[model samples]
Target chain A: MQIYLPIAELPISIFLVLGIGAAVGFISGMFGVGGGFLMTPLLIFIGIPPAVAVATETAQIAASSMTGAIAYWRRRALDFKLGGVLLAGGVVGTVLGVAFFNAMRRLGQLDLVITLSYITLLGSVGGLMLTESLKAMLSARKGISAPLGRAGHPWYFGLPLRMRFNRSKLYVSVLPLLFLAILIGFAGAVLGIGGGFLMVPALIYLFRVPTAVVVGTSLFQILFTMLAAIMLHAATNQSVDIILAMLLVFGGVFGAQFGARAGQNIRGDHFRLLLALIVLAVGVRFASEIVLRPDELFSLGLIEIRR
Target chain B: MRRAALALLACWWAAAARAETMVLSLSSHRVQITSTYTGAELVIFGVIDNERRSVTRQEPYDVVVTAAGPRASTVVRQKVRLGPIWMNLAQRKFADVPTTLAQISSRPIVQIASPDLRRRFGLGLDSILDPAGYDLIYDPTFRTALIRLQREAGLYRSEERGVTFITPSIFRAVVPVPATAPLGGYDVDVALFSGGVLLAREDTNFEVTKVGFEQAVAQAARQHPIWYGAATALMSVAFGWLATVIFRRD
Candidate 1:
């Protein structure tokens, strides 16, 4: 079946979009991560205009994260204080990101920036995760346990505005946490991601937050940040396709149920390894598109005619 | 059962002795874009009505039908390789170009009319896209790209054999509107030509609109943006929450 998207002003196969949503949802459920990083790229590949894809994906991320955040809140795993601080920083970052997005779109360079950022962000993150997982896997085969991460105060801890996060059991400066949250919010708005994949790792390794609360804290923050992105993108750009987002969320929510059940049989290290490979493959594919010579050097776009 | 398709116009030639009237009708005047909309084809039927008292001519008559969708400004960008990556470096803007244009003629437009006459009637795609209105210094490549791209996208087309004549004075043509065709009013012009001279022309218009839920949603987004955003957010939350409840019952 074919469906017309109002904001994108195009027709697309209904099954194709639903399938992408399901597949990405399955992977996100299995890995316990928000699938926006995967979804935005796939939507773009399937011929959705980048602006529409990004803004619409933000709305999906908000919906998807709501489920995870609700579960975490009920389980008492979320850190409200930390999540609140991150949200405070997220507001500032989202505003700046929305401004940057509008300007880049006007200059006709939004596609280039989006493509390059995916290459850089996904490439580095995927690479690091791959090596770390492989090392962890190898040592486990030898029956040698990996050492726990040692929490240490880096130079940033000495910065002003030092604050305490009782739940994470850390007393550190709020500067680093705020700065990281801002980056996450900015990426969520500009790149159409929940930033949980990036935020979880940063919280675990950089800030040395407790593993028990890291995922919950990030999910809580992502839910609100993406919600903020959806509203701002709608108001400023008028590019969000609610129908498209609803279809994706429907497929994803259904698929994730099966995926979570299936994931229980797999080992933790194997799960990480699989996710790393998928992430790296997406990055490689994007890199090749930029490097390879394309068949059509000419492209078409519409410019608003202001009176 | 359908309504009668007859829409008559008496377009008179200068000389009353040999004057001819053009009568035309369209298959449909309104196209609705429902969820199942794929594409549509409008078959235009027309005829040349001449008073039987006039002397019959040896030369046969030809009919040319052209349809243009609503106009909008367009930007065609060319990518140049910069530091190992291809990016849009140069762009040319064409203001108020037809979103879609389809031309159907009984014979090749070139064979039907002289170059001067063709240009005057705006018969070909090139003539329709007059480049004289460029805001910047003109370049032919951009115009070439515009036509090439639009043709490939099925937005612009011309078919010499698309129009067929059942009789010398009676004719019909088909205009293909792709699924991606924009929604708006469409103007169709039917011109009569004989021996490289313009005889008579008639014009008619149709509309493409969205009905049902599609229309409501589009209206909400444009008219009540803030409320639309809030409603979308709430609906998305409901979809998400509903999914969990249905699937994760444990």
Candidate 2:
């Protein structure tokens, strides 16, 4: 069956959208990733406008991050003190990011910027993950623990505004944490991602936070940042398609449940390897799209739709 | 609604009487786009007065029907090789371009009329762009690219031999409304030709509008966008919470 999306002003097959949402949600649940990077490109490939795809996918990220945040809250894994400091910087980053996004859109450079950002970020993240997981797999076969996460102290530890985080059991500099949050928040707003993939590693290695607490803290900050992003996109660009978001959420919610269960059976190193491969494949696809010549050079843009 | 329909019919009749050659009528004058609206199909039927000419079975009549949606300004962009990647380099703004254009004719448009005549009548995709005062620095290939892209999107289309003659003077054409069709007034033009010359032309238009739930949703997103955004965020959060509650593993 086909359903008409109101804001996008198009009709898409119901099953096709649902299936896309479910598959993205499954990966998100299994890997604890928001999957916005995956979903946005797929939606654009299927003919949704690039602007609408970017704006609407943020709402789905907000939804999935909310679930993860609440679960972490129940377990008392979230450090509200640290999250608060990060959110303060995140709001600033979101404001600047939205302004930059509007400027790029006006110049008609948003698509190129988004595609290039995705290629670079995904390429690096995937490459790092592949090597790390392979090393872990090798170490496991030899029955020896991998000497990872020991890069000594981060350089920013000596920065100003040092504060103690009770839950994380660390006395980290607030300035660096706030700066990292701002950078990730800017990326989240502009790239339409949850920034978890970027934040998790930063929290673990740079801040020396425990792995147990990093995921929850990242989710908490992402929830707030995405909330700001959705509202800003709606107010400024008017690109949020609620009907599209709802359809995606319906499938995503259910798929996440099944994916979480499926994730328990797979070994951690193997799961990371699979996710890295998928990410790398998506990055390669995006890179090739830019490198290859387009089938058609000129494309139409609808300036207005008269009612 | 009935009164409006009657008024439109009266107006069409008045226009037809002035031409005194052909009369055109659509199956419906209004298309309601409800929540479940995927697409629509309308049938256009018309009659041509062949008594004026001697009917020797020598090409009785040729009918061409065009359904053109409301005109709007749009931009066409071209991608160029920028270093190692492709990027949008050149763009042109066109005024008064139809949002949706579907042409159905008894035979191929090229066979029916000359290119000059077709351009004058605004019959085909080639004539859609108005280069009146705009600079012509861009290559004509840009226009071809625009048409190709529109055709792929199912917006601009020309179906040769789409019109069928039920009788000698009576003909009907099926006009398909694609799912991506914009909401607005769509003008349907029916031209009767004899001996490769235009006999009479009838212009009738229909309104495609969003109604019910679809209207409400689209309106909210446009008008009360802030509240709509808040509501969307809140609902998403609630949905996420509900999912976690229902599917707790441990």
Candidate 3:
């Protein structure tokens, strides 16, 4: 069935949107990551306005992470101290991201920026994840244990404002952690991604946070950051479509449950490998869109110059 | 409600200044767009009273009905190839351009009247979009691009023989309004022609508006941005919590 989206001012097939949401939600649940990285681009491909797609996907991620944060909390896996420091920095990043979004739109370069960011970030993340997961799977087959965290001290260890996080058992400068979170929050707000996929790896490899606490800490930071993003996009850009978000949430929630169950049967390395491939596939698709010549070279728009 | 169906608003300037008179009525004066609204059609039917004894030329009266939605400033951008990537580099902005423009006539617009008359009266989409009040014509590149894009979007259209004549005096036309049409008052201007001469003309307008849930949602987003944003956040969070509780994988 077709339904008119009020804020987006467009008509779209309701079933298609739900289907996309379901597929992405299943991935999110299976991987224990926010599906924003996959969803925002899919929505754009299906002809939703880029601004609306980005903002609405954040709402869906917010919903997914809310449940995730709570689950980790009850299991005593969440690191509140680490999460709090990240949240403090995340707020600042969210504001800056939205401001940047508004300025790009004013310059009529928002689409270019969105495409560029997707290509660069997704390509790098996908490539890194693929190599790392493949190495882990290979080492496991040979019955070799995974190496310890890192051989030498990282450069970030010497930064100012050093603090201890007991939950992750780390004593490092809060500066790098805060900076990592700010980047994650900014990506979440502007790209409509959960940033968990990126954050989990960063926390493990860069900050040397425990793998057990990575998912929970990332979820905590994403939930609030996406919340702020949804509100800011609504207040400033008026791009958040509540009805669109609700439709996605319904499909995503159910898909996630089934996905989580399905994920339980897969090995850790195998699951990561699969997720990595999907991420790279999406990144490649975006790359092709940018490089390939389009059928139409002219685009039309209403310049609502809010003077 | 689908339509207001207001009573006929007859000719504003007809018969008094010319030999013939015309009266027009729309199937609906207002269209209410609810959630289920896909698209709608506005019916324009009218009659010509040329039976006056003094009126002699009655070869065949031709009706040209042009409907234009409220004017708004718009921009059309062209993408230039920058190495391997193509990006929008050149843009032309048109001020006071009709959001939607449709011309429906009994026959081809070109065959209806002289080029001078068509240009003067703004009879077709091309005529209506023609930049005015300058000895130098605006760049044809931008103008053609605007028409091409708008036509692709179903915003600007021209349909010869869209208007049908039931009798020698009565004619009817249907203007298809796509759901993507911008919300605003749409002006319908009709001009009557006979034997390559302008006989009578009349113009009236109607409105397209969102009603019910659609209206409420659109209004909330624009008027209470902060509240709307907060409510959206609250809803998503609650839904997430609910999903976790219901599923309970852990």
Candidate 4:
């Protein structure tokens, strides 16, 4: 179906859109990550204007994450205090990111930025996850137990703004958390993703948040970041496409529900590795787009319409 | 066990009995069109069958087209509403969007479907058609018909459809393009409705190109390479440093 908006419009199928949402949601639920990284690019591939796609994806992420957050909160898994600190940092980072987003839009460099960012971040993260998981798996086959502990580093211990997270049993400095939030927030805006994929890993590896708290905290932060993004897009670009958001949300909710249940049957490490591989595949596709010359290089300003 | 088996059979029979018998069929399994006309003519060709019982009088059905964006923020919207016309006499009724069929056909066809059936088998219709036991037809001559419609709607062609349709059911309409068209993407919505209710909606995108912008920028950037590179690098560093400062943990 085609929906008209004041700024732009694109034709889309309700079923296909729902299917995308379900797919993204399932992956997100299974991997304890947000599916924004997947959703944004898919939307662009389907011919959505990049700006509208990103904005709408944010809205959909907010709605889907709200559902997940509520469930987590009900189970007493949410760490509101830590989530608040992250959100505080996230909000500021979002504003900055939005500024950069608008500047790129004016220069018509937004697409290039998004493409480059996707390639770099996805490639690195995917490579890390794949290597680590493979190593762990091989060691496990030798009857070795994967070491689990915190790194005793002066950098982490000396950072200012120390806070205690009772649930995770950690007393860490807030600076690292804040910095992580900002990075994730910038990524969230630039890529039109919920940033949970990045945030969960950072929390686990950098801040030492327990795996249980990581997902819940990331969801909480994602909810706020997306809400802020919606408002920013609405105010500046007027790019939020409500129709697209609703379709994706409908699909994402059901997908998350099914995915969460299915996730219980799988090993977390294996799921993480699978997700990382998928991201790597997508990154390779993006990198090829940049490196490969097209049969016909049609350019209109910052937009390249390929035949 | 026998009683339980009998109960299950009864439930299955009850569900099967509740299915609708009347069927609707389109001449084409799919429809595709592209045009640049502001107001264009559109023609949709389809066939309907009353499978259970043939009525002496023609029944009314609504022909609707809807469009939505291919992204999450985009919405499912109705582009045109036509309906309740006598089915037999209006076997091939035309629905116009006031703009022109040529303009509407100028964009990609995302989906095409009918919604009256229980399963909603058609491509575009969501709430309007049943999915099972219906045949959608595609006519070869429809492309020529679309061209003729675009000529009637009054616009020059800029592009053509990248994909082909395999269905006999087709939809043709005229859409108007604003003079102040921006160089960006737009969603074209189409759908079919009956009795003030929506059947299905399809969305596709049409992009406006801003020719030469990339070349112009490249030329300018080359003229001031060092300055451009420095400015870009500085901005990136500043943004990165600012982010670090603001989001610092403590």
Score every model by TM-score: 0.91, 0.92, 0.93, 0.57
By the TM-score metric, which is better: model 2 or model 3?
Answer: 3
The alpha-carbon lDDT assigned to residue A182 of candidate 4 equals 89
Best by TM-score: 3
**Tens digit per residue, CA lDDT, model 3, A1-307:** 9899998887888999889889998999999989898899888888789999998998999999998899889898899999989898888889989999989888888888988888888899999989989999999999997894668779888899999899999898989988988887787777888789889999888888888998999999889988989889999999999999999998898888888889999998999899899889988988887688878878877875222
For each candidate, give the interface RMSD after superposing the true interface residues on Cα.
2.3, 1.4, 2.4, 19.1
Instruction: Order the candidate numbers by lDDT, best to worst.
Output: 3, 2, 1, 4
TM-score of chain A of each: 0.96, 0.95, 0.96, 0.93
For lDDT, the strongest prediction is: 3
Candidate 1 regions exceeding 4 Å error are A148-151, A305-307, B1-18, B52-55, B132-139
- Per-residue lDDT of candidate 4, residues B221-240 (tens digit): 44544443333323323332
Q: Total clashes, candidate 2? A: 0
Best of the two (1, 3) by lDDT: 3
How accurate locally is residue A78 in candidate 4, as Cα lDDT from 0 to 100? 88
Candidate 1 retains true contacts at a fraction of 0.57
Across B154-245, the per-residue lDDT of candidate 3 in tens digits comes to 88888999999999889999987877887888889999998777788888888888899999999999999999999999999999999888
Q: How many clashes show up in model 1?
A: 0
Colliding pairs, model 1: none
Interface RMSD of 1: 2.3
Mark the regions of model 4 whose C-alpha exceeds 4 Å error after superposition.
A1-7, A149-151, A301-307, B1-250
Model 3, chain B: what is the TM-score? 0.89
Cα lDDT tens digits for candidate 1, A1-307: 9888777767788888889889988888788788888999999888788999999998788777887777777788999999999888887789889889999999888988988888888898899889888989999999998765664677887788988889988788889889998987887788888888899889888888888998888888888888788888888888888889888988788777777788889998888888889888888888887788878878888775222
